[model samples]
Target: MTTLTRTLTDTQVVAKRNLLKIVRVPEILVAVLISPIMFVLLFAYVFGGAIDPGDGTSYREFLIPGIFAQTVVFGATFTGAGIAEDMQKGIIDRFRSLPMSQSAVLAGRTLSDVVYNVLSLLIMALTGLLVGWRVRGSLLDAAAAFGLLLVFAYAVSWIMALVGVLVPSVEVINNASFIVIMPLTFVSNAFVPLDSFPPALRVFVEWNPVSTLTQACRELFGNTNPAAPVSDAWSMQNPALYTLICVVVILVVFAPLAIARYRRTSR
Candidate 1:
């Protein structure tokens, strides 16, 4: 078999092994899912009243997409934590002894985490709908929005994977991801309108990829008000394209770095 085919086959085997853990340890799936649902309910009811999205859009409608973006990004930490757990428990050492493709372990870990994020997203979507969130756009646009979120999340998983391989500690990876992701999601237009940010911070919010992802979702889901004026910043103006670019750039930069780190750590 060609190298590419070998890698793919090995990766699938590794991915299946990782996925089976979910079935055996169902609490992992429960923990993975509960946070997003809690966020939807808390934001939709608690902060939902205090926040104004303008454009006559209900806060729940505006909030759900942001929650979606934040949850998926946060979900990427699973990749890091899972890898760190494996490394800490000598699972990586066992994998190294196998004839499997070296990159398969990392690839499989990331691919399996995508399934976790998918399940999380589905639960969050149901929670959002129960709380009055609606997709006002065509089915195609909604699908594209969800696709963009997943792709971006996948790219982010590579970065986390690099950290995981480097640290090899589940707690450290989870805490580190929290420190970075909290600020990225909060400072963006994810939960609030762009106008709510101060001028200096506004620039960052406008350009922030998290903001772009949220904007892309809102636009595609028809959550944004047609009557409301749009942000002039190029990223916000072209969020879908910008988000796609971010995904490509992240994957390009981090995938190799993670793979390289894994090899070195395995050695």
Candidate 2:
């Protein structure tokens, strides 16, 4: 078999193993499914009235895309936690004994986590509709919007995979991810209007990958404020392009790192 074929075959085997674990440990699936619904309700009814996207957009409309971006990015944590859990159980040693592609283990872990993210997105989309979030754009545009979110999410899963392999404990992965992810999501335009940020933070928010992803979603989902002024920053001006760049850069940098870490650990 060709090297590429071998890698894909190994990756499928590893992905099936991970997916079976989710079926066995159903609470993992339950948590993934529930949190986005809570976020939708909390932000829609609880905080929706207070924060305005301003200029006649329903806060619920604005909120759903941001929540979509945030939740999927957060979902990437499963990749790390899963990797850490497997390492602790000495599962990597078993994989090491097989004649498989070295990159397949990490690749499979990240790919399987995409299934988790997709299920969460579907549940959240249904909840968003119940809360008055509508997709005003063409169906193709909306599909592209979701496609971008998943691509960006898959990139983040690799980052977490690296961290998971580097860290000694599955519990530590959650704590470590929270420390970084909270700031990235909160400090951006996810839950609030961009104009609310101060000058220094606004710059950061404008350039933040999370913010760009949110912006990209808003445009594709047809949720942007018509009156909002267009920013000159390259990231804000072309958010879809910007977000795609972030996805590519993240995968290029982290996928190999995670694979190398897995190899070292197996040894």
lDDT of 2 by residue, 121-208 (tens): 9999999999999999999999999999999999999999999999989989999999878999999988988888888899999999
Q: After superposition, how far is residue 210 of candidate 1 from its true place, in Å?
A: 1.0
Lowest-lDDT window of 10 residues in candidate 1?
A: 258-267
Decoy 2 TM-score against native: 0.98
lDDT of 2 at 116: 91
The TM-scores of all predictions, comma-separated, are 0.98, 0.98
RMSD of each: 1.1, 1.1
The lDDT, on a scale of 0 to 1, for candidate 2 is 0.91
Question: In lDDT terms, how accurate is model 1?
Answer: 0.91
Measured with C-alpha atoms, the lDDT of residue 67 in candidate 2 is 98
Q: What is the Å distance of residue 183 in model 2 from its true position?
A: 1.0
| lDDT (C-alpha, whole model) for all candidates | 0.91, 0.91
